[model samples]
Target: MEFHYHRTGPSPDLATIEQAIAQLDPAVLVDADDFARVRISTVLDEYALLDCLWRAGVQVAMGELERQPSVCCGGCGG
Candidate 1:
């Protein structure tokens, strides 16, 4: 529905991202496959996904990443 973002740094208390994100771009890349473990499914519901994030001690707002193509597509950009 709506887009929201929050930033968390080395120290969780000092992390703030909502002010920085007025509008979210689904195509935006948060990390470059570095300094991170695991990833989110693009097609998942934003709210439900946030629940998992909270259980893992992570905070999220709204909006979700774009869909990722499955590896079986033979690179056709499916």
Candidate 2:
């Protein structure tokens, strides 16, 4: 899955975000722009990565990320 994040104004360290992405498994730092645009690919622990970005002073674009659809039937709970 792909994830996107951005920050207001400018961003300080792409290196820091890169480092965090490196340390976080199942996550890949796809691309980061100087204007504070970030793209990542991961199949696990997305929230953890988002938190990491938040701590790094970046804002996550939750709408850009794909959400898992509900497994329940259209008219049934199960």
Candidate 3:
């Protein structure tokens, strides 16, 4: 699973976001444009990661945390 985050105003520094991500350790920092996408394995991870971002003052857009299908290898049948 993946969580996408879009900030409303000036984006937080990369280090700030990186610190928040490290605390939860749920996902990998995938991509960043005006928004950020992270790949996580479980629903609980999603909640925890979001909480971490919020606590770190990320100011993520509400309802922007959409889940997308993860990349898969056919051999694993994920």
- Clashes (N, CA, C under 3 Å) per candidate: 1, 0, 0
TM-scores of all candidate predictions against the true structure: 0.35, 0.52, 0.61
Clashing pairs in 3: none
Ranking by lDDT: 2, 3, 1
- Candidate 1, residues 15-38: lDDT per residue as tens digits? 122212212324322322334332
Query: Comparing 2 and 3 by TM-score, which wins?
Result: 3
In angstroms, give how far residue 21 of model 1 lies from its true place.
25
Q: Give the per-residue lDDT of model 3 (tens digit) for 1-46.
A: 5666655566566667666676656444644673344333433355
Which regions in candidate 3 have their CA more than 4 angstroms from the true location? 34-44, 74-78
Q: Which ten residues in a row have the lowest lDDT in candidate 1?
A: 13-22
**Model 3: ten consecutive residues of lowest lDDT:** 35-44
Top TM-score model: 3
**Top candidate when judged by lDDT against the true structure:** 2
RMSD of each: 11.1, 8.1, 3.9
